[model samples]
Target: MLKKLILIALFSCSAHALDSNIIEIMQYLQRDSDLIQRGFFLNKFDIVQEGIEKHKVDFNTLQKFNIDMFLDEKHINYSPIISSFLRNIKENRIALEKFLKDNDKIRAYEAFQQLDYNCMKCHALVRGW
Candidate 1:
């Protein structure tokens, strides 16, 4: 009985820690996304680069958590979809980097739009919308 109680306590604490990490990652994502958009609109390469770097770190940190925690009951089995979202995000990030490096604003903007699309799609899926 004592062992079971300790295990239960550990599980609860682990879940709480995962939730906290997810929330912090989402906050970082929002901040970096805003910075990226603002930089693109203002034609500030430095800001965009900074945002992209930070966003990359955020994604890496996010991958360390159990993604199912982000989903509602209706979408609990949608881990594959969430994984695809991550792939799309990675593709867009690479494209954005290449375009920005080449000084191609138009292509960078398009990649950014795709990145935004993936983010919204993932959010909708998780929220069961």
Candidate 2:
């Protein structure tokens, strides 16, 4: 009877650990999605802004988070759809960063267009839309 109780306790602890890991994974996914949306909005503002004053809000928000934080492995999933989504986000970010550093609005806008398409594609693929 004692051995059975010990086994049951061990099983319960293992199940809890598994549940925690799953929750952690979901949180990471949510964080990545939020960051992507924020970046998208910032890039949009950068394109639309006619002057520094028009961009101040987006610029401040962008500056609040280290972009690198969004590029971590937590954003990726083993599934093909999720993997592609993450890869596209990373590529788009690189392109946008380069364009921004060069002060090239045209290229930045192009990159933003591609990023928007990627977002739609990922959503349709994942959500069956």
Candidate 3:
């Protein structure tokens, strides 16, 4: 009984920690996304580039966390969906970077929009909304 209690306590603490880490990651992503949007609207590719770099760090941190923590019977298929969204986001970022390098605001804007759409779609899936 004591061993079971200790295990439960440990598991609860770890689960809480993981939840906090995920929340932190989401907050950072949102901030970076806002920065990128502002930079785009203001015609400041440099700011957009900074946001992109920050987002890369955020993604690295997120990947470090055990995503299996987010899985359950209801979300058994979540992993593949997450991978697909990550791939789409990566491709969109690459296109955005290329467009910015070429100083093609129009294409960059389109890429940004696509990125936003991908993010929203993923959120909706996760939240079941």
Candidate 4:
């Protein structure tokens, strides 16, 4: 009985950690995304008067980034769909980061478009549309 209760407590703690990680990712996705949209799409200077902030996501906490945070050396032999989804997310993030670094409006908007698509797909799979 004690062992079972301890295991349950450990699992609950892990779940809380996972939820916090997901929330942090969501915050980054929503925050910097708005910055990009305002700066690129609406051409708003007041919002990003100084300059755009770079993304601050730590990919390690993401469950999909299993085996390697760099997402290069280790590979998952999962189904093509899952593997492709992870790749798409990683690629989109890289593109978005590059566009942010360069401060290119057109490219930044395009990268945000692709990022939104991936986000929707991932969200639908994880929760719902």
Candidate 5:
């Protein structure tokens, strides 16, 4: 809450200009991703595989939250872009799952790289970069 308040103050945003759910979701993903990346580097395929499923579920939850949060066009913000990004994340998660299940380390690395790229792209879009 203090972080949100600080962000609001820093950005000089209106009361409804911020979405707390998005911040929470991003933090969740960040932590999950750090684990997955660390696990991958340590050759802990099982850990990465498990974390991918969790991230998929979290991504889906975030999508549903966005749908509910932006159901009214009046409160639209950049939800359409966010929803699209979330869908991409879900798809990438599934591909990563399949890659790990197949024991294709090379492909799994590539998929994870793409997922990371998508994360950066979505962040840039959200921040109006």
Candidate 6:
């Protein structure tokens, strides 16, 4: 009976840990999404240079966090939204990278505008953000 109780307690703790990790991952993803959307808007509208500056920090924060580990089988709550959001981020990053590489402010600004619209559409249809 004591052994069974110990096993149950261990299982409970493990489940809780997994839940917390999944929540953290979700929070990180949400943060990145919000930042990217805001940055794109600020850059396109030319109204909030500060927001674009802040987004650089947010991107660095995302880089600091290890997202791949939470994508394992232990976190069974994964969905299409996760993959879709990741892909969107990647595409946005690539657009920005290309803009920077060419030093073409006009193209960069236009890409950001498109990215902003895409993010909004996805949020409205997918996560209801």
RMSD of each: 1.3, 10.1, 1.4, 6.3, 7.4, 6.3
Candidate 2 residue runs with Cα over 4 Å from true position:
1-78
Best by lDDT: 1
In candidate 1 the C-alpha lDDT for residue 98 amounts to: 98
All models: lDDT? 0.90, 0.55, 0.85, 0.58, 0.73, 0.57
Q: TM-score of model 5 relative to the true fold?
A: 0.71
User: Over the stretch 1-129, how does candidate 6's per-residue lDDT look in tens digits?
Assistant: 999999999989987776686566546645654664565556543323443445555545554544544455643344356556546755765686578558776676666666566556644544435
Candidate 6 C-alpha RMSD relative to the actual structure: 6.3
TM-score of 1: 0.93
Residue-level lDDT of model 1, residues 20-60, one tens digit each, is 88888999998999999999889888999999999999988
The TM-score between candidate 3 and the true structure equals: 0.91
Instruction: Give the distance in Å from residue 11's predicted Cα in candidate 1 to where it truly belongs.
Output: 0.7
Cα lDDT, model 1, residue 79: 92
lDDT of 3 by residue, 83-113 (tens): 7887798788889889988989899889978
List the candidate 5 regions with Cα displacement exceeding 4 Å.
Answer: 1-18, 67-79
Can you write out model 4's per-residue Cα lDDT over 105-126, one digit (the tens) per residue?
5776676688668767755654
Ranking by TM-score: 1, 3, 5, 4, 6, 2
Model 2: per-residue lDDT, tens digit, 23-124? Answer: 464455445444544554686544333322222333334334333333336533425565565567557756866786688867865765676577577656
Lowest-lDDT window of 10 residues in candidate 2?
Answer: 48-57
- In each prediction, how many residue pairs overlap at the backbone (N, C-alpha, C within less than 3 A)? 0, 0, 0, 0, 0, 0
What TM-scores do the predictions have? Answer: 0.93, 0.42, 0.91, 0.61, 0.71, 0.43
User: lDDT tens string, model 5, 23-56?
Assistant: 7777888877877898799999878866786787
> Which residue pairs show collisions in model 4?
none
Better of 2 and 5 by lDDT: 5
Question: Which number leads on TM-score?
Answer: 1
By summed lDDT, the worst window of 10 consecutive residues in model 4 runs over: 67-76
